[model samples]
Target chain A: MAVQITTQEAVKKIRDKSSVMIGGFLGAAVPLKMIDEIATAGIKELTVISIGAGYRGGGVDIGKLVLNKQISKYVTSHVGTDPNLIKQIVNQEVELELSPMGTFVERIRAGGAGLGAVVTPVGMGTEVEEMAEKIIVDDKPYLLFKPIRADVAVIKAHRCDPLGNLQYKGMSNTSPVMATAADIVIVEVDEIVEVGAIACENIGTPGIFVDYIVKGHSYQERKNVYEELWIATNKL
Target chain B: MSRDYIAKRIAKEFRDGMYVNLGIGIPTESANYIPAGTEVFLQTENGGLMFGPKPERGESDPDLANAGAEPITMLPGGAVFDVATSFAMIRGGHIDMTVVGALEVDQAGSIASWKIPGKLLTGMGGAMDLLYGCKRVIVAMTHTDKHGNSKIRKRCTLPLTAAAVVDMIITDKAVFRVAEDGLYLEELAAAVTVAEIERLTEATIMNIGEWQESEMS
Candidate 1:
């Protein structure tokens, strides 16, 4: 029951200054073509919610948006890889919120599950404790992280069926939870097949949560991009 | 007092079939010292579990990597899961032990590793979560900072990762275990006298006479 759409059309669902949940860790399993389209469409003031910085180098995947200054705020666990993003944060050109990695993902999951809040002791006495409300249950203190839901979610999958069931080839990263926590879920996939092609056990993101499917860059294209990045960044 | 030596000492504590998480820095080197064919599973917070050794250059798979983004190979029975599930295993207390590096550790066994004031850092990836839920928390660090400041303090001057959560400390100088009695010296590194570590340590080093330098080499 998901509509197949072009990357351009899919990115059009995102509005300026809206929050977007982008799936991936350090550029792995990211919707490259969709992110590229969003950057090209000149979307401004987007609040990007991700786990970490985009790829090792500074001009691919999410890094492109940072380079373009497309992001007004970044809510992620870390941002050391991309120098441009760090510079923007240091210059106050971008507002940055850092969360503990596990807590960030749990908040998103809580949103998807329609939970009120996530209680955990991970940030009990750190800088993160200052930002969250603390609750004590049975003489134990726990930091309460509110659920996070985004206006739109752009995620990448290894493959998908016409019904929008997704399968991830490698690291799923933040895609599955983002798919559920967003008001609109747009998926970028390497291949599309019939509804029954992906087995039930293999389905990662079920069709119930997906709204649109976009054909992403081909394997060869993605490989070339990573290869070029590897050379340029000297990432062993 | 070497990193490898510290890692080897921590590796000895690993039992077969234990699910262990290793933090970046000195804890990552413990991978090299894990006993061969021990069936110990290494869980990287980035979503990899039971991965093989760090891959050689040019043979690295960028996608198959540790939390540190270093390329690694997957073992035969090893599998990769999503980040959510990875944290579930960590936060759910399914991980048996986690070894981490510390910037400061207080007498209360509190750990401060993530940040240093006025310095920019990437942020804590999964260190706090690991410490929050793992069955045992082992800190592997040098006894002193590069400037000769004792990392073992009576109280942490920096921020805290967790309070009274560290179960053990394995420094280059000695091994200390936290208990109701405070920081108890459990073992001393080879050729290191109790007086030598006492001078470098700011916290009260207790039960040194009861501790033995049994396994240190």
Candidate 2:
């Protein structure tokens, strides 16, 4: 059934201390509005798992979460620009599990596929091999990266049909696999059309993975009385 | 004669027809020193790029790139591919050499190349994958900052990029190959003496290779 809900309602399904797998490499397909809503909703002690965008890509990293203080733990491959989370982890205020970048992507792929584990040649001797379960094969030990299951997967889509079939531009697949892996997949698209309007070949993610679709809220139009002061001050 | 003594150390490793991946920051500078007429191919991690020397002004391909997300142009014979395939070249041990920037190198030759506690630098680009998966890795860097802290240290306190993947260390002072036992200092500039390096380093470094002055200007 198609669900019509606010971003806060979707985040409400995620309780405190839940191990939620988020989809994003950076801001590329990262659900920022949902993350912002979750941050504002007052949930705490949540663990987020995801990747990085080199510079200005993913907003899913700890910057916004640290600003909102919503994330308690992070199991991610890269948290590049967010210094607060790194400081918190260094200070032991937040728990962190840093994985290899490629392996982090594969971990999500394995999780959504329901595989118990997948073997890889990555992180054999490095710090990433120090997972919860470490095993050896052929006299060489391999760490067991368990399946990642999320309570909700918040994603960004370029376009969505009424039935929720999604389309994406090329090279925008940070959380594409996770889009189908989560229990509740909430997508925010720029535009929506009627069912059967989208070509089947272009429907990268099927409608079944989708539970709800919402157009993103636009804050571009809002003007403040102290807009210049606010803009300059906030720029800091 | 200059701080660019590090460049000559990296330049020595270049070979004809070598497929190389350059990391962000100073590692990218190695591209400027590749001997002319050498068929060295450059590969980036994000999306597409072709291998070549830098393109002419106003003729560079904007789509060509490295992991740093810089706008790059492909050469005449460059091939474009996806990150999945490019990383395959890295992970599958296809690339000949990979040069990355490092934050710290411990006595054990372990590297902590990513994440500074007080800095806003975001993300480790292809360094981990390239390091573990590459056949060999060269860390190109400034030996020490103006503050006089030896980046080659007892142990790294910052977050690690890869524990022990570096093959050679190229600093402005000298070029040292990291071995399982200890560091093997290969070459040094005339301005910076061996005594200065020994006094600076906290680890036990050995002189393994003969001294050779760099030929690059």
Candidate 3:
């Protein structure tokens, strides 16, 4: 059973200096309304865990937090798209911990699955090797990355039933894993349907993992939002 | 040679039925030049597989996007999954080849594309994993920087993306293959001479094989 809440109420659950996981890749599947609420709430010193920075050029979605100086630390795989975030990191305002995209997601999955750590050969001979502990098994070298768990996770989905069974339309990105790796999971969805509306096979995130649900903009509205931003940014 | 010419040359390396991942910038443009008869599936780290070309302006879907955050279309047989599964496909060695843009490439096939230390804060997105997992790693880039300094170096001064992972280098001027022994020159763009290459490239060319002129008019 999940409680339906407003975006304002959802942001209230996140405290300053909390470890938060935001699910999205660039800008595709972000919880925009919740992020907006968080930005408005002026939460500071957050440890934001995400796969990458928000859309190219910044000042959109998660980039809003960067502009607000809300995040104290960013745990992510890529930040090339957001110049604002880059500038902050360069100025020593935001601490950055980076890993390969694959390894970043795997660490989250490992956290959700209760694994100790993940051993990978992906960063064996690069700067990534300096970030993690190196281990040798059978004469082959691998890097050991610890699991990542967050205080709260905000994710976006296409639809959800009253019971909070989520169904994603396209590109689930990091939501599903982030949903499982958080203490409190707040999901923003386009629509809320009847209890049995979402078929079991179609459920992307089960109600067991979701704590709260917030109704967000519909598919068309989100499309228009991105279209406007893209046009403004000369990306369209 | 233009960036399109570098991408076109890189596209020639693809084989039919290959599952390829293209990095941002010029490597992403190589998708448009994939061979006509070839059946290549494009994988974006963002979670979509077998994605097609960019969507028309008004026809774009908010949920459908490439790794670069640009609107994209999925092919008829395409599928979408979560990020964990997407990276599993990458790290599991399911991707056949990956084409990525590089800032510098050393003679030992090591690449430095992710960071420029204190200057550029661009983090390594998935380049290290792609180089470590993909069956083949092809670097698509210009031969020199805007200042005419060679990017092909004896040693990369910047932080490396991965060491000894590049299988091929397709630049605006030449093509080189990395082997266990050393780097070998395989092809040259038209009107480009060996003397020019020697002056432009900083790394030692171990061997000059039979030079095949690139099909660039």
Model 3 Cα lDDT, one tens digit per residue, B1-217: 3888988898899899999999988998888898899989999988999998877789888889888778888999999999888888888999999999899998899999988866787889988888888999999899999999999999888989999999999999999998887788888898888778878999988864233233322
What CAPRI-style quality would you assign to candidate 2? incorrect
Give one digit per residue, the lDDT tens place, for model 1 in B99-182: 999999999989898777667565676778889889999999999999999999999988887888899999888898998779
Model 3 chain B: worst 10 consecutive residues (lDDT sum)? B208-217
Which residue pairs come into collision in candidate 2?
A26-A58, A27-A57, A27-A58, A27-A59, A80-B122, A80-B123, A81-B122, A136-A141, B61-B73
Q: What DockQ does each prediction reach against the true complex?
A: 0.49, 0.20, 0.78
Q: Pick the candidate with the highest lDDT.
A: 3
Better of 2 and 3 by TM-score: 3
Instruction: Return whichever of 2 and 3 wins on lDDT.
Output: 3
Off by over 4 Å in 1: A56-60, A227-235, B55-63, B209-217
**Interface RMSD for each of the candidates:** 2.3, 8.1, 1.1
Per-residue CA lDDT of model 1 for A134-174, tens digit only, reads: 99999999899899999999988888998889988766778
Model 3 Cα lDDT, one tens digit per residue, A1-236? 88999998889999999999999889878999999999999999999999999988888999999999999999999999899999998889999999999899989989888999989999887888889999998998899999999999999999998788999988999999999999999999988999888889999999999999999998899999978876776667
Docking class of 1: acceptable
Model 3, position B110: C-alpha lDDT score? 95
- Candidate 2 lDDT by residue in tens digits, A1-236: 34656776677777888766665444333455677777777788887766653123223333666656667777766666465666676677777766666666666777777788856666665555566467779987667877666777777666788787887533334446777567877886656778888899978678878888877533221112112222332311
Q: Ignoring the other chain, what TM-score does chain B have in each prediction?
A: 0.92, 0.85, 0.94
